[model samples]
Target: MTPSAPPPFSTLIRTASQQQHTEAESSTFMGDLLGGRLGVEAYARYTEQLWFVYRALEEGARALVDDPVAGPFIRPELMRTGALARDLAHLRGEGWRDTAVPLPATSAYADRVTQCARSWPAGYVAHHYTRYLGDLSGGQIIRDRAERTWGFTRRGDGVRFYVFEEIPNPAAFKRSYRELLDGVRVDEVERRRVVEECGRAFALNTAVFRELGEEFPLSA
Candidate 1:
């Protein structure tokens, strides 16, 4: 009667996270670009950006918290557990900048990913985004960074953005995804291109990290 959940998205996340290129470059990035060598300045800048990202997630969660469709998938109590929102408030009062010079590469990745969303069949796109954004991998990064490094939390609101309904398996979720994709009736070429473009979007993100090691990546 019901379809099964898909395999965990960890396959993709892990593959991306563990790139030797990304890792090696990140070491340089932290030192050269991020000021890992400089120590406090880089750390301060990193914290500033981290706060902005968490704040963005909080805003997104707040916007959809009461949505008829998205509400059930999200649990608000998690927000306070991480308390990112409260932390952001504290940081802002402390003079944090939401948009500092040389903005994060995530902005570029987000734009391209948005285009992929547009070209995708609405059903499949919904599945892709909801599942990708709502689960273990990306959320795990957010949680780890927030607690260990950022210190931008006083409650569970930040955590709310990371929580997902973890069933024993993901078959049910996959079924939902397949049904949505199947129903969308997208053209083969356009759908394929969208998938490819999504990969490009990911690469853009990778590039951003890679560029962090650059002495000066952008001219403007």
Candidate 2:
């Protein structure tokens, strides 16, 4: 009898995160936000929350840029903090930095990212993969909806975070990203830990969506 092959790390992370991923995508807030049922202010609030999370993620990326396991995936084209800053400024005006505030869930999420960046490179990769890959994928849908509903030009001032202007082909970029995930070298225990962190990342995202639902209330 042949032995079973070990699952790829990408598969492990995806499978473990499926439940939370489904819940986060299916959240009422997400539905309304993407469906164009929410106002521009709600989207701006979401953007504000992203700034906090990305600040932590990018800062962590700088710290782990030389780590063997994490360094390979740190592509400059994937960085969005500058784009996010531009979007926030366009949405909230020049005083955006002073006025922006992270949702409680966002603050917690940032804290976790900081902790992982400082102590565990593989752990940092989990959060990094969760946010950036998701941004390159489903995040585009949100960007389109925001532009259509709010009158922001495609890849223009307010939607710059999703633009990926530096990346000529998003599909190819994503394929390369998945390949990197598949190739990351880690032991079974560490791989499993990273998978769990991916699930936690999704849960953190869901909490933010739930809080948004409380504030926006799908009916409104």
How much does each candidate deviate from the true structure in C-alpha RMSD?
8.3, 1.2
Question: What 10-residue stretch in candidate 2 is worst by lDDT?
Answer: 7-16
lDDT of candidate 2 over 1-220, digit per residue (tens)? 9999988777778888888888999899999988889899999999999999999999889978899999998889888999999999899898999988888998999999999999989999999999998988898988898999999987899999998988888889888888899988888888888988898899899999888789899765
> What is the lDDT of every predicted structure here?
0.41, 0.90
User: For residue 164, what is the lDDT in candidate 1?
Assistant: 44
Q: Give the worst 10-residue stretch by lDDT in candidate 1.
A: 118-127
Query: For model 1, what is the alpha-carbon lDDT of residue 107?
Result: 59
